[model samples]
Structures are given as C-alpha cells and as structure tokens.
Target: MAASPSLANDNKSNVQRTKTSLSHLPYEVKQCIVYWVDRFQKEPHRFGSDSLLDQIAGGINHPGKTESRNNHPLLAPPSAQLTNLLNMHRFFHTTSTTNNDNKPSIRPQCNSILALCLVDRMFYDICRPLIWQTLDLEQFHLSKLRSLRTGGLTRNAEYVRKMSWRISVHELEALWPDLREELGANDEARKGQDWDESSRSTEILAILEMCTKVTSLDLDLRPTELDKQTGEFTIDETETTSKFFYPISRLTQLTSIALTTPLLANNSFTEQFLVRLIRDMSELQSFKCYGTDSVTPDLEGFSWPLPCGSPLGLHLSELTSLKELYLQQSDCFDFTWSKIEWAGNLEKLTFDGCTRNPLRTLHAFCQKFSTSLRYLKLDYLEYEKDVYTTLLEPTRDGPLSEIKSGQYRLDLPELTTLSITTELPIDLLLNFRDCKNIKSIELAMNPSISAEQIRELPCFWPKLEKLKITINTKSDLARCQITALKMTYWGKGIELEIEDEDEQYNSARFGHAYEDDGYDSYDSYHDDDSD
Candidate 1:
C-alpha cells in the first residue's frame, strides 16, 4: 500500500508514484475508475458482448488501440461524466474500426459479460455487484433449466454467473412429465445417507437466497401440464415451492414487480401467488399483474394450494401499502380475482386487457381511492355491458354487483397523465373535459375506427401539457383538436414544450435496431446508438 503522505503529495516524483497503483487512488477516484473501466472502457461490456472485440480487430483487439489511442494518457481512457460513468476506450475502437465477424451478448450484465467472461478474473471480482443492479426473470429461461442434465444446476450456474439474481424461478418444470419420473428424479438426494427433503430443499433454497439481491423482478406464470388422471395441474414443487418462494420472500427491496403470463388459462395459482407475493413484498412500490386468460372462479372443495389453505381474495385485501397497481385480462366476475380495492397511492397503471365486468365494478373502486392516482394506461380496451348488473337487475334485493354509475367514475383529482386505447365517442370526452390537473393524454384508435368516429371524441384535452395521438392516417392530425401546452405526434417521440438542439447527439436511438416496437420508433436516432 502506498503511504497516505505519498498519495496526497502533489510534488511526488516518478519514484514516489511508481510505488502506487489502482488501490492507492482515493476512494471516490477508485470508484470512478472502476465504474468507467468496467462499464465503458471494456468494449465488450458496452455492447453487452465480446463479439465487438473480434469485430473491431477482425477477431482481435484493434491495432490502433494498443499502439496509439490506448497509450494516450491525457484523454485516452475516458469514462462517463459524473452523472454518467462509462470507460469507452474499448467501445470507441470497436466502432472506429470495422470487423463484423463477432456476435454481441444481449442484455449482458456488467459482471459476467464485461467482468467475468470477457475480462480476466481480476476484473470480475471488482465489478460483480454492479452487474447485478437490475435483473429480468423471463419464464422461458428457467423452463429450459428444468430439462438440463445437471437437474437445472448447469442452467442455473450459467445464468447465475451472468445475471447473478435477475432470473425466473417458476420455470424449473417441464410442460409435461410423468409423475413417477419427476418424483423419482427429484428424490436422488434420498439415496444418500443424509437423503431427506431438507437436503433437496437446501439446494434450491440457496438459489433463492442468492436471488434476494435482485431489485427488478418479473414473474410470468404460464400453463403447465395437467395430471391426466385427476384433471389437476402440476408444477415442479422444487422450483415454485422452494426456488421461487425463498427469493421472492426475502427480496424486500424490489422496486418494480411485473406478474404476467397466460397460465391462468390452465393453472390456478394466479391469484394465490399474487397474494402471497404481495404479502411478502411489504415495501413494494410498483406492481403489474397481466393475465392472458379468463379467470375462473375458485372451486370450493379443492383449495389452490391444497396443503396451505389460502384464497386469493383474502391475500389481496392485505395489499394496503402498495403504491402502483396494474391489472389486465382478468375476467370481471372471477370470484377469486386480483383487483385493486384501494389504490390511494397508485402513481402509474397500465391495463393490458379490457373487461366489462371490471368496468362496472370500477366506479365504486375508483371512488374509494380517487385522490391519489397520477397516471392511467389502457391498452386494447373496449367497453362491455355490466354482466354483473344485468344479472342483479332482475332481482331488486339481490347482491350489489353493479356500480352506481353506468360508466366508470374516474375521480382522480391529482391525475397528470392518461393513456387509453379505445374508440372515443364525442360525448365521452365530457368525463375528462374539465380535468384541470391532467397534463398528458395518449389515445390509440383501432385501425378499423373510422376517421369520422375518431373526430367525434370531445376535443377538450386543452388542459394537457403533453398530448400524443397515434393515427393510421396522416390527415388525422391535419387539424388536430387538442389545444395543449405541448402537442407531440405519435410518429415522433413525446416531444417536450421545449427544444433539444443537442438531441441529435442524445442516446435516443441506441438499442437493437430490429426491435421496432412503438416505444423505440423515434429512438432510432438516439446519439448513444453507436458501436
């Protein structure tokens, strides 16, 4: 270690400095250097793959990097600005030179791609934690693990090495498997002297404990095979029961949680898991639950989790601390459902599916917590008649299944933005006609909606500070109605009332070019989209 006096000495000579190295730098300086080298300077890390190296060097490091650019001491090894830190020495060369033989890793974590796999062990140790800052647990990735030779060990290890904690847990089961083989294979630890559920459980338990570090968790619960004999669905007990539970239970710091899948079609854990998950995440700030199937009422005899007798509705009532709630594709009348009863603090909401039942129930639900909503999103939405009310209408003393109002009452006094995909009627605009606090409104029309019908929506979004409309015809906005403070077209990005002269050099268009999702349309020109 260099002496403290030597580190601070401004007049130190080469002899004095020769004794110092990366460790001798101040703590802040060391952090900056490591942040740059690991995140930016390492060319492979920037592109999230090592292919960039071969591409730049024709399967090697660029000749000029080692001979000229890298050797420059003054500005050669540059990192990102304070707010942005990236060491771009490697990345710059990859782009400056041309070599396209190598492939880049997608969603490469800083630890595995840039640190461990691409760099030497020395680099791996320093940058491990940063790579795990954010994780994405896609369901398919884990499903593949269930079929691996090492009994999900190889898949788990390889994935863990790169992602660290961002991974899916419930995918550790095959779509179809014989009950005997599945149980027998999972019982190998029983063959040993210490063979017991405890040992087998411990193996997967460790995987979950490691996943506690994940800050962003995405869970997709899709359909699995049903037991042909009993007409009951089956999941890998070890994966969902052990591997999935532990991490979810302990990951209390998660800020974003997305619960999605089409499994509710054939499976019954949709509501059960959602409740258990919400209960476990007491500090959760963001929650999104999207279902791709109709929700069926829970049967009275067989509980979802037979061993642990708990229902979804009871668990949902426990989500008192939640701030953001999003629900989609839920059948309105499903006795056991995932609906937001009290979203007093919800800041953002995106409904991917539209249901008439929920719409009827929404008036009362919205009134219950109308004071705290900020943003609302509706996609693929279409109004439906209140089946709940229609049934109750026949009997006067029947259950209060329908909402008091025919249309959903949106009393969001603090709402700032509203995004909905629907055909707006001219008279329907009266609902938000006088919303003074609303600053932004995004509405998507179906391709089939006539231009005449499109114009029928009351043009009273004038209070909007930002208005975005997607039109199939160029003439839709020819004399666009909403006179907002800031009017932005869907073809372009959410343009601000202000201008960005330097927008030409911004990172607006800097991701996979082929992913032309509407979100990235205007992003094609993002300045950061270079090598």
Candidate 2:
C-alpha cells in the first residue's frame, strides 16, 4: 500500500523541524552534549579487558598482545592489503569480550561517533577533535603511519593531547619496507644499503614531530623478541639505540613521562641524557621509570660524598616541580638520596621491588622528607638488618628515644595513605604515630601477624576509613577465619578488604569451605548479627 501524499508531506515537515531545532542550539552547548555522548558510548570497560583495580594493584606488568585476524602476502598485493589494514585499524580492531559459551572473542570497535558525524556538518566538526585527543599506538601498523603522512589524518595531529607508543623489534621489522618506500628508495636501493636502526628511529621521531601538543607520553622501547626457551633478549648497545632519546629530550612540554626500558639500567649515555632532560623540563611533575633490573646509575668518576654543586647534583636540585617519583625494580634510593638533601617538592614516593639497602639509609631518607610526604608505598622491600631493632627500637641515647618518651613522633604530618610489605607491620605503624591524618592503609601481612594484632589497628588510627589486608598463607581455612574476625572488629563504616596471596588456590578452596559451612558466600560472614 502506497502512503498518501498528505501523510508523506507531514513526515517530511516533522523531520525538517527537528533538524532546525538541533541547529539552533548554541555552539558550546552542542559541543558539551557531543563530548558527553562520546564518553558514554566509549566507557572505560569498553576500552580494554584490564580493570582500573588491576592496574592499581600492579597485576599487569606488560602490555597485552593484540591478536591478529588477517594475514596478507608481504611483497605482493601491497596496495589492496594496505587499504584493508587501514580499514581494520579504523573500525574492526578488537576488544576482549565473552560469548554465552564463556569463551573469549573479538568485539568490534564502537562507531557511534562516526554515525553521529553523518547527521550534519556541525556534529562532524565537533566530534573530530574529541576522537583524536588520545592515541594508543600499541597495535600500530606501518599503514597507519602511511595514512598520517599522506594528509589522511595529518591535519588532525594538533588535536592529540596524550600519546602512548610501545615500540618493539617486531614492529620495526614490519615497518621497514613501507618506510623505505616512503623515503623514495627503489628495490635496488633497498638491497644496496644495510638496514640501519637510525632509519627506524627517524620514523618514530617524525611521528612525534607532528603531535606537538602532547602533554603525557608513555614510551616502552623494550625489545619483545625473547628466546622461546630462555625467555630473554640481548640488549642492543649501538649508537642507533640511543637516537630515540634525542626526540624525547626535545619534548620539554611534557608534564608526565613513563619510561619502561633497560636503556636507563644498562646504558651510561642514558644517565647523562636524563640529567639534561630533567634540567630543561621545568613543568615536569610526575616521572616513573621501570627497568629490567635494579637501576643503579653508573657514577664511576664521582668521588665519595658527591659535591652539592656538581653537574648531576645541580640538575636534580633543579627539579622544583617534581611531585611523584616511582622507581620499580630500581635501586635509585641509595644513589638519589645520598646526593640531595631532599627532593624539592616530592609528595608521593614508591619503591617497588628494589634491592635491599641499609635500614638506616631508608630511615634517614624518610625523616628528611617527613614534612612534605603524603603518600608512600614500599612494596616487596627488604632491609640489610632487622626492621624493629634498626628502625623502631628506642635506646636512651638514640634519636628514636624521643618517639618512645612522647617528646616527638615520626613527623609525617601530611601523610594520609601508607602501603608497605614487611615482616613487622605493627612495629612500622608504631613509628608513624604522628601521622594522625592517615585514612587508608594497605598491608601485605605474613602468618606471623596474629588476628589479635589486627584489632589494634583502629586504636592507632581512629579516623581510618579503608584497610586492605593481603594474607600470605598456605592455609585457606586460617585465612578465612582471620578475615572474618577482623571484619567483626572493623564494623560497617570502614571499607575492609581481605584476600589471600594465592588467588586461584584461595578461590577453589573457599568454594568448598563455604559449602560445608552455612554461609552462601564469603561476604556473608561480614554480617554484624552473625555469630
């Protein structure tokens, strides 16, 4: 049945009226609506499989690999495959999701913004900048770079504010042919010249040059080509390996920088480069470095008690804006602390998996920054001597005696959060009695800490709001009983979380333990009325 002429005319008039109403909205209002709609469409969970909690708990060490879905011949059919690859990069990239059968499968990228752009030209202009604000080049292909070079997305480079590039040897190998082509090298020219790593460095530098407004940069230059049997890769020590540092040092506008590579650990040139880099960036606030091993900078020529006015010492002293310093698997504590009296404005400090140092050195370092330090995390740290006797014990003649007699306390007045993994958490807490404002504490406790010791926590910090206790135990029943007992004392106002060290083992054992008892779940034991 065909529609009547009057009905079709009325529908057309209604559609036009709605479009006119949308167009009449103010420019700022339209932009705000579009920005929020984009965020709603691409929520955090839709971005990747890993949760925010996993990142905070340090569960993920390295970036996850992107599963490949399509393959093409390397030499032949370059044009068609390049187009297909760009299309896949644009839309078909996968995010992890589960099917009804409880198996992992690929979920296509959300294209709501692309659909919204097609509604009108105003919507298209507003949504384009938001889409290009953050670029994660974890699954970068050579074709994507090619697109950027040919003015396909080159004009949008100014919109980028944050960028992360995780480059590996495999990515360099895949990029070689396209890079040579872009450089105007013919087949004969490619065969005549040797493959120089500097050419690969130049390609990365070129990409960075386009994004001048980037404020946060995450660069992981660690090689991914590990031996299958040994699970290790040889560190490359050539001039070309250090070329990437030149472009990075030029990014003085960056406020936050996270670098995960062994260059800082193995290369002497990296130490000098870092000093120069830190000297130039006056606005740099947060710096995090993760290395393959303990990052003890090679200070070979320097004499004992490095002079305060020395080049390295002067450069570090110039970091008046540095607030957060995190060194993972790095022994920068001894070298850095010994050189300077204190980091100028440092508030948050983390030393995760660092090598054992003298307890007195750590004690002196903390005391130096006690007034300004707000958050401290010492995970998996070890000491050369007993912590209680070396740090907590009070002798009549020693400075710690003031803490025992109530004349003074460990003066971390600004501290509100503390996380530590040690044998004696109780003794460590006693040392920080002056931190009256501390609201959150995370402790990795061993079996030596009895359930009775947990009850004493509230008395120490009456304003405590959150406590996360991770028990290192082989006995599941013991962990459960201890957790239940702690919850009883903690009550309902505070947020309390208890978990075992072996997550998988605890999950399997807790199922049977809960079934045997009357409780339906572990959380049920938290009820105040329960016996």
Candidate 3:
C-alpha cells in the first residue's frame, strides 16, 4: 500500500475540521447544549427550540473554553423545600473566599435526564425513566381536593392513585358525589344516613377506605372541619376514594398512617373507631398521630370516655404488629401510660417534639426495646442537641440511659449507634461507651456549651469506627489549634501498644526531610526558632 497519512497529520486534520465547525456554531448555543446535557443528560428538541449555539454562524478562531463562572452551585436540587434549606449549610460552609478560586458549578443530574426525553424517541426512552423517577410522589403532598374531587372517582382520584399518595381529607368531600354515584346512593338513603348520629361520614370513611389499600401510603390526616350536629367530619377539600369504605373493620393493608389535627380524641369520641381501626389495620407498619384531650362533649351527662378498663380502650395495647411510630408534637392530649403498649417488633422510633404536657398517665416512656431499636431521634422538640446534657448535666459517661427519677441508669443492649448533638457537660464518655455493638456515633454542640465541656469529648466516645464530633473553639487562629487524635482498640489481653500501624507521627518527621529518588521534602510543619 502507498504510504498512509502520518498519525500526527490525521490528528491535525481532525482538529482543523473540529475548529472550523465549532467556531461556526454560536457560542451561546454550545453553552446551552452543555447546560441542557449537564442538568438533564440530553440535548433539547432538534426540531424547534431557541438555542444561542444555533445563532452563531462563524467566528474568527477555534472555539475555546470561556472564563469560569460560578453558576449552578448546587449539584442536586433537593426534593423538599426543607431539604433545600438544609443544602444551604453545605453550600455556605464549602464556599471558598479566595478571589481566584475557579471551581466549576454543578447542577442536579435530574435536569440533564429530563432534557433527553425531549430530544427524540430514542433519547426519550433513555431519559424518561430518570426524569419520571424524580417526579414520584414519595416526597410530595396533595392539599387541593375540592375541585379535583368534583370530577369523581372515574377521574382524578382513580388516575392519581396510581402515580401518587399523600392525600388530604378535603379532597375526599369533593369526590363524595362521585363516590355516592359509584356506590349506588339514592336520595332517600343519603338523607337517612346523614341523620344517623352513630354513623361515620360516608366521604371521610370512603377516602380512608380506598387509599388504605395503596401499597406505598403515608396518609397524613389534618382535621379541616368538625360536625356541629352528630360530630361527623367534613374536610374542606378531598378526592373521591372507593365507594364502600367499611368502617375501620376492613382496612388491614395500610402501610403508614399519620393522624394530624386531632380529629380523634376523648377516649370516648370513637370507642368503636379505635377498636375497629387498630384491630382491622393489620398491615399498618408505621403510625403517627396528634391526639387531643380524651374528650370534650357538647351536652351535659355526655360524660365521655366509657371507663378506661372498657373493652374499646384495650385495642391500643393490642397493636403488636406496628413497627415504627413517630410522636411529632403529639402531646396536646393527656393520654395515659396505659394508652400505649410495648410493640416488641418495633424497629425505629422518633419523638420529634412531644412537649411534656402533664401526661395524666405519664407512663409510656421507656429506654429499652424488646427487640433491637435501630434509630431514635428526639431532638427537634428541644434546643439541646446534646441529648446527654439534656438528661440533667451528665456528670459521667455511660449507662444512665433511663432517667425516671430525673436520673438515668438504663440499659440499652442492642444500641449499635449513638449521637449527642451537644457539648458534653461532664465526661462525654458514658456507660453507653460499653455499647459493644455500636459502630457509628455523631456528637455536635451548640455555642451555648462551655469550653471545658468541649475539651472532654475525646475520651467520651470509645471503640467507635465511625465518629463525627463538633468542637466549639476560639476562632482566633493564633490562639486556637485542633488535633485529630486517632487511637486503636485497647489491647484485649496484653498491655496497650503505643505503636499503631495507621499512626503517622507528625512531630517525628523532619520539616525539610528529603528522599534520594527526587521525593518532595516535607514542609507541613513550621520549624520554630524558639523550640
């Protein structure tokens, strides 16, 4: 064969071609394409769309990277507005003050994935899943129901039920007519049912009945309206759920339920309600509710709450299947200790601000679980992140896990992790340091804690493989320094070894030590003349 073109010549030819075409494209259009691909992972529609890149016919020279601009600093657009607020912490903390910093900005990849769907059928197929996955109702809520519910079960609720959850009670009302129509309601029967005092509202019962069957449900019910006559409820807006939502006797498939706005209270309001709710909701894996005062009757001799030892009251103690419970600001009611029972199967629990409001039966609190409890968070209620200090100035570290007499001496055998997001007022190390199963722990503190408290943290957390500690110190660089001390597990049988394989002695290394094979000289530490 004749002499083939040189490799360099071939590369040069390709470069020349790239330079010519790239220069001809509008600069803005190219940048637009980058942004579109960056956020959504695909280009815009090739047929009809305004792009800066498409405008530039030609340029004098080859296209070159423009000066850096700190745009799209956040990489992922968080799902919740609350999460966006939280992301500001990382953004503000990580931002550099240096004038010449040239770090590239990042946009969430979800955007790029969305753009691809609009490009072409092939690209749409590839990007549709990513784009839609982000739209899943796992993190969203539907609060508007009046109008949408008007469309009836054949329309909105039927359609949305397949794609999303988190429905409001109001939506249920608007869908009442459709539901009534679907359930074969006659005008004469409707009036009689409405007049029935002992009966539950058909619409409210319907939404609960229909949505409870959904596999992925975390229903949050906020009381919108309370009946003035028979005490039935009618939310402001809601969707039409399935027709015959038999009172709580049949809803056994619910996965999660959040009862907000005290629609059910006064151990008497719905004796049948509780009995039927707990007994029938067998599939309810997680539960939360903000119950109100046990009862507030409208008329005299109404003496609500049909005796505490009654059969209806015993249903709560029977909830053995419930796994996770969140008591979020749920202390408006003076529920007694006997109201709740220990769910041996519980795995995770959160008490996010259950204000201590004279619990008439203050007996449900406990420090131990029948099985291993994996996660527990109770800090959002109070300002103190140091759950230890909150337990009355922890003077020592470890086992005081229970503090009934305003003191803790509790046992947590299965605790594999612990976190105290506040300064250790006493020895940060507590008997909990003996939590042999623990592998992760996070300790943070507010500015209110004293300096001495922060200094005692090193010894508090022991045997931890993963740890996060926040120390409040003087910001004055000349007066402050931080040391990351790494220690190995204490010797089990023999003496403790001072030498560890992972240890690197900063003090031993020479400031200017050099190696023969052109190794760089050490220069991390300053050689003080005084020393």
Candidate 4:
C-alpha cells in the first residue's frame, strides 16, 4: 500500500531531500526493501506466551521497580520526540549511513523505516508509516501514548495498524495514579479499592482512540497482588481490574484480536465488557484467546461464572465474520465449542492446553463445521477417556458408542492439516478415517497408539504430504518402529519428522532431561510398550 502523507507528515522540506539514483524506486519497492532490512531483527522469544508471570502469587514489589521484566528491547515504543524532530527538520532524518556493520551487537532493532529516512526525503516520505505499522507498548510507558497523541504525534498514531501490549498488574496499578491524574480523576478514586471505572476506561479509550487504524491487538494482561508485610508480589483475589470493553469496542477497524493472558478482565465490568466488545467487532476475522497455565488450566472443572442478564456471555459464535479461532489453555467455560453455533466461514481452529472439552463435543464440532474447516490443531489437549482401552475392551462405549450405535461416523471432507498431541484418544483418530483431504498429520506417541495403528495412519490419510510424530521417551523402541514405517511407506517423498519427548516437552513445556535412546537414563527399563 502507498504510504499516506497524513500518517506522519506532509511537508517534503522537513525530510532530508538527497537526490540519490535509488530514490527513483517505487514506494512499494521501498517497503519491500525495508522488510528485507528488518528480516534479521531479533523477535521476542516468548511474547507473553508462558505463564511464569502468572505463577507469581502474593504481593511483590510494584511493577515500576521491576519494569525491565516485561521490557522487550526489540519492541521499544516509538519515540515521539524523534518522530516530531524528523518532521520539523531535514537534519533529524539523516541517520548514520554505515551499512557494513552486520554484527548483531551493533545492529539497530528500531523500525527499518528509520534507516530508509536516512537514504533521502523521497524514501523517508515513502517509508515513514512503515515504522508505526506495528507497536509494542508496555504498561509502564502507556501514559506517554496520550502525550504523543496530542503533542505532534497524532499523525504517527493513525499509522499504527497492530499493537502488542506487555502489561503487568503491578505496573498497571503503579501507573494508575498518573493516568488517573491525566484523566482528571479525584484523589479518593485513586487511593480507594473501588477506582473510578469511568476515568480508567476513559484513559484506555483516549489511548486507543488515537490509534484509529489498529486492526490486530495482542494483550498480555497478568494481574499481581502485593504482600503488605513480606514485600513480595503474588496474584491475590484483589478486585482491581480495568474495564476495556468500551475502549476496545471503539476499534471498529480491528480484524484480529488475541488475549494471551486470562487476567485481562479483573471485575464484572471487564468480563461483561469483553462479551460486548467481541459482539461489536463486526470486522473481526481472526480471534485467539491464549492462556498461560495459571488461569484457565487451573480451572479445569470449574465453570466460569457468566455475567447476569448479558446476552453475549463470552460466547463468540455470534461473530459471523470470524474466519480463524485459536484457544490455548483457556477454561472450557470461558468459551465452549458446543455452546454456540460457529459461523460457516470458520476455516482454521486450534485448541492448545484446552483439554476439558468432552470427546462428544469435539465429535459434534467436526460434524457441525466439517464442510468449512481446513486447518485443525489440537496440541497439549487430553481426551476425557482412554478410547484405545475402550476400543480393545468394550462393555459400554461410555459416551463414544461407535460400533454399537453405528450412527456417528467421522466425516470432515474439507480438512487439509491436522495436529494432535499429548494424550489424545485413539477413538478421536478414528474420525480421520473419513478425512480424505488431509495433507499433513501430526500425532504424539503414547501407550495408546499401537504399531498397527501407526501403520494404518497412511492408509486413512491417502493424500498425506507431511507426517510428524512425537514419541514419548518412556515408549520403548517406538522410534525404531516409526523409522521402519518411514522407510517402508514414506520413501516416496512424504515429509516425515520424529521428535523425542525430551526435545518436544523441554522446549515447549517444563524442562525434563533424558537420554538420546529415549529414556530417563541408560539403565532404565526397555520393555516394548508398542502393541
């Protein structure tokens, strides 16, 4: 897209007008150049994905003192001063021209558009909006966003299309007084437990209003509680939560929204607001509610109390425009697949650490949306019962009455990609018997999967292009069987990947040590578990 002059500045004289031969390139080409230049920048390893912060219970020092904990050096917020100065004079746009320093230590992690600004005025004018397209804002510096909006930074705000906020409950609380003062909140409201929701909502609204063009938002809202005597930080039952519904509802341009932490909502207003917020986002296409283990994972069986008299009530099926849905480690009550009839347009669905959903619910899901679904990922999700055992020794199928009932047949004609990991039922895999369109399949090895079952996978997925299986270290000699299977059938060019549980679990979840032979130690028992 061509850069908008109103996005940053319209004055050509303010930018360095160097007449270089490269300046003749098109604006889109310059954006391409900026992309390649920034391709090597180190991205955040874990952007609020892990639940380490959530595990910290009880009160600790305020977030201001520990602000560096959440600060991502690569995603530093935009400098209003630098942007304003660049807009005022050409000299400010001209940066160091040294291009030979390829060393990582000397590399600049700032937006690549800044480098283009140094090239010439034409390039600067063409590439300025590229810098503001995506922003990583921390709670500590959120107060400055309002200043940037009013004081010569409004143009830059409109350029923002995506935003990721790394918020700490402590830091948000610490900065509350300042934000309250900025919004003209009273002293009583600032000190009291029941803070003025209007001022708080207005503060967020003010900030979000400035970034009128934002479409995607990733929020890491981890709440913390303070210990009065011990001076420790922990998560307590404190009711201090911010209301974001009204503020977030104003993002009419939003298409993609992701909540990486469950503590984003603190009180009734925030919870109810979230439902309304989702309902109002008419343009939303991709929605993800990611959870760290601290919140949803802990409330496995507990039902999330729904707001009274609220029609929406956290059910997202009403979002007819939604195309992709991703839920990770979130409680089943937060949003149930069976509770609402999903839009027919839904294409990609992912469930991670969200294992509480019944097998029947999943079966029904595939039956309901099988025509439109294409990509499906079920990772770290466990089945309610051991379908493998039930299939082998069947008195009653419990809820999975397959052969006796003979009514429920697995049928998804549109699915192309499927991934399942960690304690998935063998009966669930039977559903793939009818999914002929599956091109890629990922399965995690457990005691439930027999050698015969593994051999039959390729038969079921005739169009399989890629196969990835994770073998648990405890499963004896399963790796050898997988290798044999690969050599037997996969020599025809199907991509095959077999990862040990140590490698998969260590990097992905809690660290667990192991041997290269897929055991805890060299002397561990080696009885064959594969049937």
TM-score of each: 0.47, 0.58, 0.41, 0.56
Overall local distance difference test of candidate 4: 0.52
Question: Which of 1 and 2 is ahead in lDDT?
Answer: 2
User: Among these predicted structures, which one has the highest lDDT?
Assistant: 2
Tell me the deviation in Å of residue 377 in model 2: 1.5
Error (Å) of candidate 4 at residue 66 is 52
Candidate 3 — what's its lDDT? 0.35
List where candidate 4 sits over 4 angstroms from the true fold. 1-21, 26-118, 138-155, 169-207, 220-245, 260-273, 290-315, 329-344, 353-356, 380-395, 399-408, 425-427, 450-456, 477-490, 504-531
Show model 1 residue runs off by greater than 4 Å: 1-25, 29-127, 137-209, 222-256, 262-265, 268-270, 276-279, 292-314, 332-344, 356-360, 384-411, 426-430, 447-466, 472-531
Clashes of each: 12, 0, 34, 13
Model 2: ten consecutive residues of lowest lDDT: 509-518
lDDT of 3 by residue, 1-531 (tens): 899757477456433432223224344433433333432222111211212122222121112324322222222222353232223222121223222224532323434444434545555443333332211231222222222233333222322211223232222223234434543545454334332211323433444344422432333233322345643444343322212223433546554444433122213123333343456675555655544323322221233543334333245445666556555454432333334454435555555444542112222333436245554433333333464234443564322233222243324556555545323233223434445555555444344444344344335444444544444342221223222122222221111112221342322111111111111111111110011
- Residues 1-531 of candidate 4 have per-residue lDDT tens digits of 996556336544555555434566655445434433333232221112221122222222221233442353212332453233223222112234222222222233454447667788877765556556666554334345445556644667766676765344333443344454553545564444223333333444566667776777766443343345753333333322234434565677677777644333542123233454565677777776654222223332345642222233234666777777766664542333445555536777777775554554456665668778777777775545565236544454444556224344567888888877766445566666688988878788777677667766777778877777788665664557766877755555666677887864232111111111111221111111110
Candidate 1 lDDT by residue in tens digits, 166-285: 122222222223323444555453233232323333443454455434444554444344456763445566433334553554666665566555332354335544554556666565
Model 3: worst 10 consecutive residues (lDDT sum): 521-530
Clash-forming residue pairs, model 2? none
lDDT of 2 by residue, 1-531 (tens): 996557366455533433234455556545544543453354432233322223323322211213321231221223543333323233334444432113332333477567657667897887777667666653454445545555645888877766665454333233244543554535444332233334444555677788887766766553333345653333345534354555666788777676666333243223333455445677776776664232355453244664333343345556777766666665444544544754476677767775633334455556677777778777776632343235342433332333345533467878888887765435655667668888888887764566676667777887777777787763233757775755665464666667767662422100112111111221111111111
Best by TM-score: 2
